[model samples]
Target: MDLDQLRTFDRIVREQSFTKAAAYLNITQATASMRIRALEQLLGVTLFQRGRTVTLTDQGMTFLPFARRIIGTVQEGREALRRVERGRIAIASLRSLVSPLITEPLLRFQQHYPGVDVVVNEGRQAQIVAMLHERDVEMGILCWPNIDPLLVDLVPLVIMRERVPLVVAPEIAARLPARPSIEEVLALVPRVISLRWWQAEPETAAALVRLAKTSVELPTGPARRLAIKGEGLGFFVNSAVADDIEAGRLVEIAPPDFEALHRDTAMVVRSLAALDRDMLADFIAEIARECAKVGIILDNRLASLGDKVA
Candidate 1:
């Protein structure tokens, strides 16, 4: 019936256990049970089917969306008040983009707004989206073509597209002929260290897999390292390995028959009205400037938004 009970119900649905939800909320199991019972009584319907594992009843399923909306609205109200009282900005970003895309822009933002407090959380795409929905962060930085229904209500403040190049160590590049075909490169070094950090097309991903005699899945950091060590060829966003390529640590290989690949990263927000317009504009400008330094170009109409905010 109350926010606490609704929160408890939502947490239980997420955690799939009353005991776990209680622990997460830092409340006693008995108290959690009492709140749920109170809520069920108020609603005149059994919400959850009690069992070894928590399963939502038909009525609970019907109420879940409403519960989430109420929670989100309350959270938004709290966030708006907090923003007015204190200069606080929070964002979630993909781990791979943190170093290349987020760090420099954040430093520039701090220089401009020294009194403002900034919090950055790093996670995968899905986790970042969940954080946005839960109102845990005001904005998120992630790869584009998300296709998640949850993003329908959000706005993309900035979108940057960067080329994805095939790279390998200097020594590995030396062993290959000029303008080598993908098959020719794979013949010399059959292993391909793959990182799916970008939202590549399904057919493109499958094609890359098929080309590699030994396809190894790795996180961004490790995949870059392996490619630097000449263990395998790597497909990476240009910004990620730009310094390495410039320093002669990694060399980009252009296969004549291979398709040109690009990945788009976006800065998304729940609503523009909840943000400090001037501050957000400055932050966006800083990000665009930094990305351009690494050859990542703004691919969307956010430049006009930035101008309007300015």
Candidate 2:
């Protein structure tokens, strides 16, 4: 009936665990159960069927969207008031990619709307998802494949794709042949600089894992630094090291039959309703405009979302 009750219901469904939902809400499990019970009683319908694993009943499925809308409506009202009183907006993205990707867009947004305060947060995919679901951030810019619909209804806007080149230190490249096989590349790069969490997709992550004998996994910033210092052979997104490769600091070590490695990025919102606001719409536009400067255009994948587009 109330916002708190609706939030508990929503989080329970998303997390699929009463214990996790309770912990996330900073409430006791018993209290969470009681709230759900009270809500079901008020509605005269059993929301979730009790079982070893909680599954939403027919009633719950029908009510889910309405509950989400209610919570989103409340959050939107708060955001509007915050704009007037605090002049603030929150955005999140990867720390390393933000500079090459969104820095120009954000700068232009600031120039045109200097009065609006923009708070930026940087983290891995899981962290970003948490922030989005909690309404801690109004927008997120990250790899498109990393967005999971169950966590949040993302309004994905693919801005660019970069080839994932296999590279080594310039000195190492000189000693190696013009092209190497997968096995040779793996053997040469004993300590491959792999990203532990921020992969383009699950299949890509699995492929990389199988290729590396001894991997040195790190987050975006540290991974780039280690790769640059020639600790070992590395595979990286082209944008992350395009300058280094151009300057001859890094060399591409391609396999004879290596497929081009392309990763796509998108601008996302928690829900389509989240994008209905003018501020968010403008921000999305700014991202597209800035990406155009770098020759990245809005992708058809985003265009296919139909009415989800703002």
Candidate 3:
């Protein structure tokens, strides 16, 4: 019924344990229990099933999203007030994109606006989206195809397309032809280290699964490392493996039959009117500039903004 009750319920759902949630919230276990009991009594439904591990009941599952929205709304209001009091920017980004996409722009932004506080939270796609919706972050940078502006309520400010090339250790590359067929590459090195960096073309994703003798999904960092260690061939963004390729640590394989692979990463904001317009525009320009330095192409829509802020 109250904010404390809603927060307690949300924390319990996330922690999946009353004791753990209570500890996190810095409240006694009895107080946490009492809050939940009061909430359930007011709602007239059993929210959680009593057990060693907390499990949400049907009613609890139904109410969870609403409860989270309420909590997020309150938090958002607090963040808005804080922003007004001082210059602060919070961003959520995909883990894989942090080094390749965010780092340079962030460093540049800081140099220019030393007084403004910037925070970057890295997570998977869903987690980043959640952070944006919850107003835990003002912006999000992530790969595209799953984002729907209408559905997620996040507006795309800029989108960058980067080429993803199949790379392998130099030793493995030495055994293959200049323009080998995918089957030939597979024959030479049966293992494929897959990183779902983007929503790859369905046919390409399926074909890799069908043809590779051994396929293992890994995060971008580990997959790139494994490819460098000669464990398997990996498809990595050009920026991610550029240094390695230049140093002869890895070789890019261009298969005649394989479609060119690329990933689209976008910078999105929940509401532009709610943000510091000049600051946001300046940061977007910095991102575009960094992308260009590494051969990532920005969307046509951002060209005008780039020019204005460049």
Candidate 4:
């Protein structure tokens, strides 16, 4: 019921092992177990199925978002007070979306507002959305199609569309048909390492599960790393791996009906009325400029890939 118990529970779920979670939180394993037991007794339902490897029960999955919100609330309050005192700005974003999207603009912002303090919190979209709803962050940069209106009324700015293509190492690409169908391509790839966020979509999630035998879920960075090694096929945004594609380290594989996937990237503020209007607008403008640059780079990369295909 207390913050400590909640923190322990969250860490345990993340680490998926009592011992590792305890180490992460700098507590003993017994203490971690005790906290989960206490929390379960208070909730009147078992949160996790205790076994060799910890797995969340149905109840745990239902409670996870609420638990995150509770922690986010406290952190947000502290951040609000910090902002009032020291002119701080907080941003929440997915781990993969941070680079090239927020990094350039953030660095520019720091140089422009040298007096203001910036705090960056990176997590999955769910966690980032919770932080935004709880007011833990002043602004957030996230990819589109994953936005939940129930979480927060997203006031999006600078919506940029970037192409995401299925890519593989040159050797793997060489083995694929000149222009394979979606089913053929899916069948040919020995493994499909999908990013978790992409799997969040209901249709994609179901399709991925259908290929569960050969698919593995990973975060963006690891998925790209594995793809570069030709370990498996990976679907990634052009901006993230344009250099690799251009340098021939990775090859874009276009299916007969590839559908040309594009994701919307946005810069959003918590609320138009709640924050400093001018400051938010200025930051949005800066972020938009950087996003434009990214779009240009992605377009160029895709064009190069097209030239190769032709």
Candidate 5:
């Protein structure tokens, strides 16, 4: 009948114990029992059957999904209220696109909304989305295509920069005495720096089909530095490595046409509709204005690809 009862049911189902649920909700065990009793009385059905081990009744089982959703919706609403009270919001991002997309908009958002503090939580896409869904962060900038349909709102941020040549040390290139090609550099080298493609679809291009020679799965931050140290050549997003290439720490050579390296990004919102938070609409408008620099161009070639996939 009330959000608290829904919360109690949801916690009881998840934790499988009244005591545990009470501890989680920061309420006493009796208060939890009373709430559930009130809920069962209002519903005119037994929710959970109590024994040494608790189990949901058939009616409770039927109600579980709705109960979880209601509790979750309530939790999301609370998070937005907390955000408004705190005058702060958090943003999440994938490691690769963190700097190029998240940093710039965040700085601009801070300048424009000086009273609101911005927190950027950078991690891989999965971790970022999990944080957003958990209400650990208010927003996430991550690749598009898959997000929790219920908990989050996804908006297209950018099309991303064009791919770049992945290279190894020019010195290594000279010493190898092999043809100066990204392929040769990769094949002949003892170890080519490996980007943690945890979410990356493996490049199945004929050239890239060969497994990495000596792979190291370092976190995104460290992977960049290790590549620069000449320990191994790393393949990275052009946006992440562009400045470094100019700095001469790593050479950008003709890298393979990696087959499955598609990266897209979006902003994740926890409860835009329920919380009456209309700011993301304004934020999306700003993104559209920025992406208009080179308006959407539809080429016959890409259209054909779409058709084939379609």
Candidate 6:
């Protein structure tokens, strides 16, 4: 019922673990459990099936959406109060997208709307969604998948997509007998991946695994280095590594049959009832236009998986 309870609940659902949620929210485990218990008692439904591994029950799944919105509402109410006195807008995104795609545009956006402070949240997809659910940010650029329906809308913004090369460190590449096939490279290379791309992109997903994800996780920045060092082949968004490719640091391992792969980009919006809402709408439109003017192709439906990676 209280904002604290709602936030605690949201974190619990995000992490799917009581202790992890407590650690995230900076509360004791007992306090986190107590809040969930209190919330369940208040609502008359067990939210989570408590055990060695916390799992959402049917009721827990049902309660999750409502809890997110309630927490979102509480945060929005506070922000609305702040906005009435001083303007602010927040955006969360993958760090990659924010680099060249958004940096200058944001500077220009701020110039026009000097009163509005743009707070940017950059991290993996789940973190972005968690921030959105907690009302920590008003807009988000995130890799796609498992986004909850409670979000007002997820605009398919297709910033860019390129084929992921199986890039081993050049030494690793040199170890190969000759050119390699995609399957052969995956089997041979030490894999690297961001939590986001590994989790979000279907093309990356298919390459790495299938069936609830055989889950080969990797560190964030190693793919590029791994390719240079020959540690492994990892996925890179094409735009991200063009310079490296031209510089010959990483080269796409070509398979005779290899042609295409896929990934998606999206913008998450706050639910409709939220405030500063109109400004956000305008900002989204302006960004779409600006991206187009720069040849980003705002109507980005399908981008080729060229000889690039990210």
lDDT of each: 0.82, 0.73, 0.79, 0.72, 0.61, 0.63
Error of 1 at 40 (Å): 4.7
- Please give the lDDT score for candidate 6: 0.63
TM-score of each: 0.82, 0.74, 0.81, 0.67, 0.62, 0.73
In model 6, the runs with Cα more than 4 Å from the true position are: 40-48, 55-66, 145-163, 166-216, 270-310
Who wins the lDDT comparison?
A: 1
Better of 2 and 3 by lDDT: 3
RMSD of 6: 6.6
What order do candidates take by TM-score, descending? 1, 3, 2, 6, 4, 5
Residue 222 C-alpha lDDT in model 3: 80
> What is the full ranking by lDDT, best candidate first?
1, 3, 2, 4, 6, 5
Off by over 4 Å in 1: 1-57, 275-277, 295-300, 306-308
Q: Which stretches of candidate 4 lie above 4 Å from their native place?
A: 1-77, 145-152, 182-188, 199-213, 274-280, 296-310
- Which has the greatest TM-score? 1
C-alpha-based local distance difference test score of model 3: 0.79
lDDT tens per residue, model 6, 71-154: 667777997797788777778877666664567767767777888877877887767776776677877777654455445455
Off by over 4 Å in 5: 1-64, 83-86, 147-164, 175-183, 197-200, 205-210, 255-262, 268-310
lDDT per residue (tens digit) for residues 60-176 in model 2: 999998998888778778877887796677988866567775788778878877888888898877777767766778878777666466464576765566567777887767766
Clashing pairs in 1: none
- Model 3 regions more than 4 Å off: 7-37, 47-66, 147-151, 199-201, 295-310
Q: Is candidate 5 or candidate 6 better by lDDT?
A: 6
For residue 256, model 2's alpha carbon misses the true position, in angstroms, by 1.8
lDDT of 3 by residue, 181-284 (tens): 98888887758887777644446756876788989989877887888888888678888888889999999988879887887877787775543456666776
- Give per-residue CA lDDT, model 4, range 150-224, as digits (tens): 365676644567777778888877877898776766665678877755424435434644663587888777888
Name every residue pair that clashes in candidate 2: 164-261
lDDT, residue 234, candidate 3 = 69
Q: Clashes in each model (backbone N, CA, C under 3 Å)?
A: 0, 1, 0, 0, 1, 10
